[model samples]
Target: RFDMAGVGDSELVEGGLLYVERTRADVVASMDALSERVDSRRFLLMGLCTGAYNAFRAALIDDRVVGCILLDGYSYPSIRSQIEHYRKRVFQLKRWVDFTKRKLGIDTPSGSAVQGDLVVFENEVVSKERFAGELQSLIDRNVRLLLVYTGLGPLSFTYRRQLHDAFPKIALDDVATVHFYPAADHTFTLPGHRQRLLDDLDTWLADEFESETAARG
Candidate 1:
């Protein structure tokens, strides 16, 4: 429930948004504080949006993190995703209207598929190759990863199989689980959506803990 520096109750710092190194340091500091107070050795990192990205980054470096729950973390559209996006758009009424207008030289599309506000970090981009490598490293360390995606715009993840497509070299079955909720918004604003998310989390956590216990014995 802790907020990163410059967010929520924490004091703002200079150059906070430009670099992720500070965020990662904050996560480690929080984990250290928790360890001093609790007897538990296992830790689970769960976050949404930017929080998700930080959690994932922390998990990669910290072996103490047993599991991670990421909600719409970091995703980039692969070539296949791009093709699928435009393919679906081709059938939509609005797309055709826009296309016709462009053909008639009446109107033109303004920008790329990716939105400007969606860009959170500056000068730090995680390539798909590096991401896959990090994912594999986490898997090798026996870290459990749960990726959850919502129906928010700029659909980087429209299908369950996109993860596999993005990291074709990695064997995800042994370590990763993915869930998609195409009807819900990014924040799960609706009561039903929230309930569904809770239920799913509960089920997954129970299963994950059981497996961890079995592995220990």
Candidate 2:
């Protein structure tokens, strides 16, 4: 639950590529400090959106990161996901209402999904081959993962199992734990959505590492 620099309780800083780099450094530094202070050898990193990317990159460089819980992380474009994503929302009345509001400028999201103050970061996905190689390398090292996708704009993460469909070359069927929640928004704003996510987290952590943690404790 540590807040890295440029985020809550830390010195505010400009967002963008620089912010991404800063967080990567922060994650490594935090792990290093934790290793020295608590005599901890292994760690699990969790991040949301861009932070997830940072944690993932850090895991590649540091073997100490044994697991990650990535929420709304890198979502590659998939025709299948796109069709299903649009199909689910196109018929929904709420979608029409929200579209109308945006068209009329009644409730516009900040930055319009492009470069702007709030949207300093774009939903840029790494190349499929490159990403597959990187991810497979991590898997080869036995890095455990929990990937989650919600009803963030289709551009962010449209559906659950998007990761599997996006990268069939990688044997993620058994390697990763994935969950999707189409009813929840990007940030899990609804109480029900948040509760569901928390419950899932509890279950995942317990199943994956509770025994090891208890033995250490």
Candidate 3:
């Protein structure tokens, strides 16, 4: 995958901003460039963080995108998600110790509480209703969707079931595959974590693409 404009080796415009629209445009441009060189029409968009968001959005609009692998992508927490997050934190001894220290004026509160309000992304947030609709559209088109979560932060995805729980109405099991690697950090800095990430990707790609090929034949 190529880097977005103003990032990595790509030339950055003086006042360029990587907003949603611009990011989508860049993805389209990249696809167009690829088309000129490759004979294949099918494409699978894969990315992490904002890149993942872009890939999802791109796949929704572009019929050529047969699949997408989203890593730490859009996560909208539900009321239950918020409750579950704090419920887990409540059991942590460090949390109690910190609370007691603050109560006794021995230490100041560091604002590290696991809360939903803290789960904000820099770009505009898509409504759950709209996301659900988009997700359905992709499923109807038979796009292979893979969502992978890492141990970046619990605020966005506190648990393995958070995605399914947030969109209870949507039948995600029928449309998407999800994996959670809570022990691995966001970037997968450690060698073992990186290997785990790669292994997961290899398996997903083989299974998804092989199934698609068999279906076409």
Candidate 4:
């Protein structure tokens, strides 16, 4: 539940892209703070959505970071895909706005993905400010932008397969990789699947802890 300097709990500056800093010292300092709080020589990291990317970056640097678990990791798409997706969204929003205007004689702004179900695309939804912040952090830290958009993308299955291959190598004695509840969206809350997701998460965590204990003996 710990956050880095420019994010949630730490909240450094109040301007554009707080996480976009070149200070490796700052990154490690944040890690040090979290590590001290937990009173542990080694720690497990878990991230959801953009948090996954940040966790990945931190794990790469700190050996004390013994393991990581990521859910619904988003791979950055090419500029072309970003532009296309943006244009498509704009067109769809315009169409919706026009229809609403015709029907109600007024236009409504879109709601944010954070506020409600993103698929529903409510008119009252506000812009997701987190995206710019998160993406900027990823870019600043040079976190490997996955092949393309994180969830169900062109390489979704491939990325999972690669991770599966890496599992044996990564889930070593003190070090481990645990992916809980496959396809559980970002928060591990998807319709008609919470039970299955919970089961998988429980199994993965149990196995990880068990394996870690056995390694100690």
TM-score of 2: 0.76
State model 4's lDDT: 0.47
The lDDT for every candidate, in the order shown, is 0.79, 0.78, 0.80, 0.47
Worst 10 residues of 3 by lDDT: 108-117
Tens digit of per-residue lDDT, candidate 4, span 1-217: 6555556676564435434232234545666877689756666566655565556556566666555565555332344545655566677765566667858967455445222323421112223344345334433443322211134322232233343243332222233232333344544346546565556656666765677668877
lDDT-sorted candidate list, best first: 3, 1, 2, 4
Highest TM-score, which number?
A: 1
Assess every candidate by TM-score.
0.84, 0.76, 0.82, 0.46
Better of 3 and 4 by TM-score: 3
In the range 134-154, model 3's lDDT, one tens digit per residue, is 988998898988888875643
Ranking by TM-score: 1, 3, 2, 4
Residue-by-residue lDDT tens digits, candidate 2, 49-113: 77788888889888998899998776785778678756866898865876798788896555453
Query: Which pairs of residues clash in candidate 1, taking residues 3 or more apart in a chain or in different chains?
Result: none
Per-residue lDDT of model 1, residues 7-69, tens digit only? 889986676455578888888888899888985567899998778889999998888998999
Off by over 4 Å in 1: 13-18, 76-80, 107-109, 112-123, 211-217
Q: Name the regions of candidate 2 deviating beyond 4 angstroms.
A: 12-19, 85-125, 153-156, 214-217
Model 2 steric clash pairs: none
Worst 10 residues of 1 by lDDT: 113-122
